[model samples]
Target chain A: MAEISFQLLLLQLMTGLALGAIYALLAVGLSLIFGMLTVVNFAHGAFFMVGAFLGVYFLGLTGSFWFSLVLTPLAVGAIGLLCERFLVRPLYGRGIDYPLLLTFGLSYVMIESMRVLFGLEGVPTSVPAELKGVVDLGIGSFPTYRLFLIVATAVIIGALWLFIEKTRYGLIIRAGSRDPEIVRILGVDIARVWLIVFGIGTAIAGLSGLLAAPTRAVNAEMGIPVLAESFVVTVVGGMGSLPGAVVAGLLVGVVFSMTSLFAPEYAELSIFVLMAVVLLVRPQGLFGKAGLMG
Target chain B: MSNAILSVRDLNAWYDRSHVVQGISFDVNAGEVVTLMGRNGAGKTSTLRSIMGMLDKRAGSVVFNGQEILATPAFSRFHAGLAFVPEDRRIVPGLTVRENLQLGLIASRARDTTDAMIDEIAQTFPRLKERLSQEGTSLSGGEQQMLAIARAMMAKPRMILMDEPSEGVMPVLVDEMFELFARMKRNGVTILLVEQNVERALSITDRAYILDQGRIVHQGTAAELLADDEIQSKYCAV
Candidate 1:
């Protein structure tokens, strides 16, 4: 019994980390949009969903998963630009709840439209030949695809950190995240900054969808569940704190992975429990700073 | 010196229907540092906001450089050679001093201001050069004020609308601000300075407007306003 429990812990940890990578990416994207535009981005899940759908269709037709990987996010990002130009721009200064609703409504549109085309069914995506097979860790044998996913997430995240902290444009993003009004005074078109951020954020969400498509059964409903999970991780980690999201993602992932050991039924709710505790402990989130936006 | 760069006529503004700026009017001429003087809530701030068209709703005829500019949006107004620095200071806390200054030049893309042009402005505010890499919010009250002025000058606007440059600054720094405004005047940038310090305002401005209860109660050469104790006692005095 003890050996079985230990093995379960190990397997869940591996599984959770992979899912957590996707969640962390989604949370980071959500936070980026919030940091720049002050919008909660309820449409995020829809963007993620779009990435997955595009990944499957494009990869299957072109027989190039990598090509789909590059195109899907950029295409979704363009859609995001249009969304900002039309729906989001008009809603600026109208308060947080308004954009939240607007994105939320937009989410349904994106999902239903995809649903109408694809029908309500789950689609399975196979791993490419290059990433297939097993990677042997000292404890056990893990799929190479899972290992690749983890490494890819790390590299992408590392690149993002550098882009945000090191580059000149990154500095603007960080400044805008901390203070958009100040960003404006320095003569930056606040709208232009917002548009870039919106594009990058939706692109990240798209990437999350593309990355997850192979691992999970793809369906229109896939995005909604991941969206809820990502928000749980975001709230748990700290809203608008990039590092916090990373930590929270890992923590939530581990907890969920561990909880499933005892009961798969309660696995989903474990992160929410952690979220409630985090909220109780730190209302501003782990790294959230107040008045930065106002 | 008396070429009016910016002028407002019968300007009325609102924050969602409550009238804040009640048809007040004034003029700022080229290369002149004119102070908008008032107590708190006297509409001095709104007048400046209206000049930049920052208000959500407003009715007025604003003419900048002889062109009627009442229809211009806040973002477009920068193209018309107007700059606004708000009371909050609005320094991006994480961005270095150089980044803050460069943004003004980058955003405007005006002829006089570029990244290299900002370096020239940096020479004028040596404190900025010393702390070029320092995050803007990290600067002291005086240094941040200097940075704000430097960033504003990146555009080298025909005029600058500065809201309350003296407020929240320490006593020692207050005098330095006066000297900077003086230097700015020498550089040929028309400036509209808002201040609570009546004596300083009178001394710094070429011309002055004393706003009382959302209206201009007095307007004259700075010396004339200083000598009139009745206007001083009623409106300018603490």
Candidate 2:
């Protein structure tokens, strides 16, 4: 039997971080939308799945990984705008559950449509040449793609933080998160902000798909499991807190990694179990505000 | 007088069918200081919210500066020269004082405004000048209130709906806030203040409306309401 050792733990940590990077990206979008628009957007996972396929389709057309990387998200973001404008916009200022149900229905429709075209089997993707090799780690070899994934997550998070903190539009999003009424009173057509936020959220989901496409087999139902996991990440972090999502993503990733080590089959069950534990303890998740729970 | 700057007639509002403001009507004339005064839950805040389109559900006509504005969205109302200073201050807590003011300017038709106006108002609210580089959350309550008003001032609005300018501040700050309002009035910015502080509300306002159960129960000049012991005790007494 392979005894648990420091190197093994280190490997798990690295593995967890890689997984966490993807979860963090996906959850950030969901948290932001909930924060500003109070919409659950159940279709968020479907968008992620759609993005992966988007990469497959775009790469087939352009034969360039980089081109697909940029365009897939933009395409997904545009679709997100249509979703928000047509379905989510009407449900604003109403009970949040409205968007939850509406987006849930949308997710079903989107997934079914993709199924009719792509079939149920997962599609394969190749790692771009630049990211295909393994870099020698002092302890063990690390895939260059995994390193790229880490750096990509960092760069994306940093850019998003800068956009929300330094730019004028960022101020509106932050303000809108707290009190959309005030955002409007300042004379911004908040509807536009909502559209932008929805686009950005879906774009992030798309990016997650593109990032993971080379690592895993993509399929019509691929977004479903990730969707459930991202929701867990978002809720455990906080419904609308970006910081909350990052922390929760890291926590969830590490937990799942460790669980797979102890009991491989239990890895799937670990996420739900942890979510239950969090709700039992903090109730509002880690960074989530208590007063806002109602 | 010049068709009144903002006029509301028989406005009814709801928060998902929970009637909050029922058939309330009041008007703010051009460059006038009007107020809606009542106890908490008496619908003074809701009335202002209804006029600003912040109420979840509201009905009846709201005319602003000769235009029918009842159906207008909140941001559009700002473009038509109306501004609303929320009850909670709603200062962008993470932003610097200047940034918060800049955000307010940018939110509306920013093309017409300039940083020079920010500098000018920053001069008026000296507290804001001192805190210009500080995060909005770092300021004291009074300073936050000043930042809120200074932000609105940057937009150069024709009218502002100020909700409880005196709430949640020090007495000295409250006095200074009223003084600031007086200064704003002299500058010809139309205002509609909503306050539970009847004495202070009456002191600064030309006319006052007493709201109760979402309806207009009393309407008269500020001085007249101040003298009426019965109205003050029954409706607006703290």
Candidate 3:
């Protein structure tokens, strides 16, 4: 009984980490957009769903998951670019509420459009052949795809960190996030920066969705749950903080997975519970600096 | 007029409903350091902001480099060789001093010379040379002011609109800043300065405009303004 319980614990921990990885990716994207543009992206989940759908569609056309992985984010990012230019650009300096409401409405439009195009049925996606199966560790067996998810998220997040810390454009993004007017006066076309930031944010969402496709049923309403969870993650991690998102995502995931093992019904509820507890302890969230957005 | 690098005429600005800068006109010639001196709320800052295209509700004829640029955006103004150093010295948080300096070159064609420019800036501002990796906001007020000015110089702009560079700085550092401005002036960079330090300002300035209630009350050469005690006592006692 002890041996079985230990193995179960390890399995649950691994699964939890995989789930956290996805949440981190989604939350990081949301935080990045909010940090730079000061616009809470309500349509982030919809972008995730779009990414999955695009991935599935691309896979079907090319019969290659790798192609889908590489192309989906680019395609979805282009869509994000258009959305920013047409929808988000006009609302800048009008305060945050306008963009919030706009993105809220945009989420509905994107969801309904997907419903119309793909129908209400949940489209199934298959795991790539190489990633399909289990990897036997010394202590236990774990799904290979879940491991890949964890590794891939780490790599992507690492690259993003380096980009933000090392590159010149990244420097502008950081400075612009603090005060765009200063950046503008310094000679950078801040409008273009906003557009590109929006693209990158949604592209990250799209990649998360593609990663989630094989694990979850791909449907119009699929983003709704993940979106809620990601918001919870964002709040728990402290809104608009990248590192906070990452740590909070993994913590929420582990809590969620551990709860599922003991009581399946409380698994979903556990994430909110963790958020509430974190909020009670630290109102600004785990790593959030107060008055940052204000 | 042809030699004037920045010329503002019939300029008016409003913040929301309050009409702040009312029909102010000023000129800063090429390779000249001009001071805009006035009491608090006299709209000296507003005039510079309007010229930089930072003020939204502004209408004016601001000619720079022989072109009318009242309609141009703020970034484009910078691209056209106009730079601004705001009074507050907005050093971006979470970015290193090096990264902050790099922001000055972000949208300029002079980005290719980033390393050389940074090296030159480091040599000029020795206080910031060792703190390049430190977070910009962590620097002292004097160091931050220097960082702000150094960042502006990275673009190698033809002219700079400086707002109160010596405000809230230590006495020694204030002298250092004025000395740096003198060096910059010698390098042929035109400057339009808005300062509360009237005595120091006139010392470095070739010409000066004294603003009273959003209008140019007194305009003269620095020597003439220094000698005329009546105008100085009325508009620039502070």
Candidate 4:
């Protein structure tokens, strides 16, 4: 029993890291949007679902997985831009209630529209030829695709970090999050900055969806549970801290996976439990700056 | 439009429903250092904010460099050669001192073609040169004030509206700030300064405007305001 449990723990650890990559990608985008516009972005999961759908369709159209991988997120990002300009922009500074409601409504529209078109059946996305195998890691065997997810997520996050820290425009984004008015006074077209940020954020969510579609069943309702989990990660990591999102993502994933190892029935509930514990102790989150949400 | 660097006429400003500045007018001509003197709650800060287009509700005409910019947005005003150094400094968190200065250069009305402005500002503020990599908010109160002014200068603005640059600063730094203002004036940057330090402000500025309860009670040469005891006592509390 002990040997079996140890083997399960190792396997689950690998599973948790890949799951954490997905959560990190989604939560980071959510955090970016929150950081810039202070909008909760309830439609983010819908964007993810749409990206998965777009990925499947694009693969069908071009007969090329690579093209689908590149194009889907761009399409979703454009959709996000439209959402911001038409639906969300008017509600800015009127307090958070209107944006929150608008996004919730948008998420409903996206999911229902997809359901109408694609039905409630789960669509299986074929794994790419390059990633269609398992790797023997001495202790256990892990899917090569899952390892790819972990690596790809890391590369994308590294690029994001470099963009925010090394580039001049990135500086504006960081500074704008702290005090947008000052950024405007400094002469940046803050509206354009926000539009681009919103687009990038939603695009990341879409990318996460596309990446995850191969592992999970692609259905209209696929994003619902993930959305709940992403929110828990966001709140646990702190509202707008990028590093917080990452660490908290991995931590939540590991906890959930570990819980499943022993108490499979309690796996899903473990995330909320961890969130409550973290909030009770450090309300600002591990990396969140104080007074941002309060 | 008037030929002044900045011209304000009958400016009234409010803070979201509460009218703060009522029927005030002022102008800063080319190459002149102008100061607005008033007591606490005298709407001096409101007047500066109105000029910057930072207030939500502001009425009347404000012309900069021969164009009326009352309808222009706050950011466009900066592009139109207006810069405001707010009282609180507003040093952005998570940025180094150098990065903060770089933001000023990026936001300027005209691009710094040579990118020599940063070096020039560093030379002017030697203390800033030493702490270029330090976090902006980690600086001392006086250093942050210096950073604010230097950041404004990085824009190479034709005109700057500075509000209470001396607050929370040590006395020695206050002297350094005044000296820097004098240097800024000598370099042909038009300035409109708001301050509670009546004596220090009057000494550096060419002209002075005294605001009391949202109105300009006195506008004259700095020497004239300094010489007048009653106006000083009534409006400035000096």
Candidate 5:
């Protein structure tokens, strides 16, 4: 039997946290879309992939990382907004199943379109000059880009939290998620709210894609595994709970990282086991309210 | 017709294919409390919802402040000085009382004056004043009804369409709510009310319309409706 090493565990923990940050970003967006619109957006992964490609294209056009970072989400958000207004809006009141099926089809279209445009090979993303080095911690050294990703993700999540908690629109969103019929009767333009929510959710997914570009090999098939992973994180976190998504993301990331360190074969399997345990014990997910699942 | 603040001409409403409110017509003058009284499923609630543009399959004319509004949507009707307080008293969960009131303000393009409106609402409903920070779902049944009314008042509406304000409320709160309605009428806010409590509704309303099945069977002064026990027995059982 191999002896446990504290140093190795610490390194693995750091990697897990970094990976969890990305998952949290993806899962929170999914939760918001599901909570507010009740649409299981299978197209979310495609949105992320498109965002990565857009980020690369925007960088090529502008030669500025800052511009791509800002523009990628906006561009993807517009597409999402259009989709909501034209496509998803009609499916509402028909049933939940229609939107789910529509999004599934949308995902296939996005993937195929990207394959046609970007070709079959994975695109490489270069780390910016300032972030292309090692950061020396007191105990160890780590890549600066990885550290930047962790910090950037934290800042983004914090900002998102503040927006949802403190803003007028956020209050409406929270209330609407529970009872939209009441919200509509109160004289609110519920159609507009739905559009904005879907847009924001897709934008965040796209932003995650852009953020992941430098860390992963960007290809047509990249979105599938990540989409499945995001679903696991969302379910484990308690569907539609922002804080739940954050906690579960980090937990899943750490567990996957730690498992890979010890038994590489069981790395992916660990996430499913945690999900199964959460399901058996608390079917509502970690932070989901009781009686809300139906 | 010219003096009336709200006029409904042959108003019809439906839930999908089910024609619920059939040819219901009524009118309310400015600053008057008008009641629509009926038994269960007599289309009284459907009449109110149709006037507010809440029912998509609704047809016929709703003229508020003398502008034809049959073509208007629900939210747009709100901006035109109409407010609706439904029977359910839909208090949003996870939102404080103050936040719920804020939603009312958002509905009628009254968001900019939220602070002053909130202060007025607090002053109007003393029961809601102390519990402004409490989650809306935590309130008692009567208090929740009061909050729903107070929320509608946030719009500073010219008129309010209320559906069964007395439902599930204690007698004391119901009396208090009627008194509040009287006070609102005195202050120049018109009301179109729906109620199952025929006796209590007659005491406060100037005029009453008794609906049967899906149409208005009787319309008269509140005193006339109260005095005519025969009309009451035919349309309203209680």
Candidate 6:
């Protein structure tokens, strides 16, 4: 066995945290959609893939990473809004299964459409010069982009928390998540709220995808693995709980990273293991209310 | 008929094939507190819900302010100035008392004046004023009920359809709620209340209707209903 140094462990921990941040971003969006709309968005991963492709398209057009970063989420979010209006809205009150199935099918359509338009090959994104290279920590050196990812995600999550906890629309979203019928009776156009929530949820997912592009391949099938892993994060955190998604995401990320360092083969398997243990121990997830899904 | 703010004619409603409100008819005049008193499952709540457009299957001529609203959606019905305070007093979890009150103005024309409206409403319910920052659901049962009523008032509604506000509340708070209703009546706000506390409800009501098995079995002035103990025991028995 190779001797592990303290610096190496710290580096692995930082890497894990960065990975976890991305997972948290994706998982939180999933949780928000589920919480507000009560629809399991199978199309989330596809939205992520769309974001990356949009990033590639926009970056190629402007040769500016910043432009792609700003444009991808807006474009993808608009797509999400349209989807909510046309696809998801019709299926509500018909029961959860119809929307679930509709989104399941929607994911396939998104993936196939991307494949047809962009071709089957994976696209690569180069990190911006300002964010490239390594920064020296007292313990060791870490990539600036990775640190930037962590900071950017933290800022975005903070903003999202403020939106949900402080703003009036956020109040509606929170109340609507708990009892949509009551919110409706209060004269809120609940349909509009759902539309905006889907837009916001997919917009965040799109942002995460763009952020992931420099580190991971941008391909038609790219969202598949991330999608599966995010579902684990969401379940472990508890469905429909925002804070739960964030905490569980980071935990899963660190666990996966540590496993990757110690036993490379078990890295992916470890996420499932963690999920299974959490389910057996606390079925509602760490922050999820009991019987919410039911 | 001209003075009636809410006029219901042959209102029928169902809950998944079980007809809950069978052709129930009633009229609530402007600036008067009207009560619908009944036993459990007597369709009192159903009648209110149907008027509020909450029931999916219903047939009725519900003319609110002279506009037939049976075909409009629940939210639109609210936009037409019909506020409903449900029986459960659903104080939303994870929301503060201030936020709970904010829910009342979310879709109202008064939404732009949220803080001012809250301050104005807080003066009336002193209990809620002290706990504006506290989570709404964490409050005691009575406080939650107050929050629900205060929330409905935030809409600045022309009429309020209150469902069992006195249910599950402390006797002291029940008295407070009735007192508030009396004050609202004095201020010229129309009210249609569904209550299990027959005597307390009748004390403040102008007229009372007793429902039995989805139909109106008795309708009379509050004084007449209060004097008739036989009608109360026969229809509103626990």
Query: Per-model TM-score of chain A alone?
Result: 0.94, 0.96, 0.97, 0.96, 0.96, 0.98
The TM-score leader among the candidates is 3
Worst 10 residues of 2 chain A by lDDT: A285-294
Compared with the true structure, what per-residue lDDT tens digits does model 3 show for residues B1-238?
Answer: 7789888999999989888899988778999999999898999998989898988999979999999998888889888999999999999887889888888888888798888899999999999999999999999999999999999999898999899999999999999999999999999999999999888999999999999888998899999999998988899866
Q: Model 5 off-target regions past 4 Å? A: none
lDDT of 4 by residue, B9-65 (tens): 999999988888988878888999999888899898888887777888999998889
Clashing pairs for predicted structure model 3, backbone only = none
lDDT of each: 0.81, 0.86, 0.92, 0.88, 0.88, 0.92
Isolated chain B TM-score per model: 0.93, 0.95, 0.98, 0.94, 0.96, 0.98
- Clash totals for all candidate models: 3, 1, 0, 0, 0, 0
Q: Which lDDT tens digits does candidate 5 get at residues B125-193?
A: 999999999999899999999999999888888999999999899999998899999999989999989
Q: In model 6, what lDDT does residue A211 have?
A: 90
Per-model TM values vs. the true structure: 0.92, 0.89, 0.98, 0.96, 0.97, 0.97
Kept native contacts, as fractions per model, are 0.49, 0.81, 0.93, 0.81, 0.65, 0.95
RMSD of 3: 1.5
Error of 6 at B115 (Å): 2.3
Clashing pairs for predicted structure model 5, backbone only: none
Tens-place lDDT digits, model 1, residues A32-128: 8887788999999999999999888888888898888788889889999999988899999989999999999999999998889888895678888
What are the clashing pairs of model 1?
Answer: A186-B103, A186-B104, A187-B107
Model 3 per-residue lDDT at B17: 88
Candidates 3 and 5 compared by TM-score, better number = 3
Residue lDDT tens for model 6, A203-228: 99999999988888889999999899
DockQ for model 6?
0.87
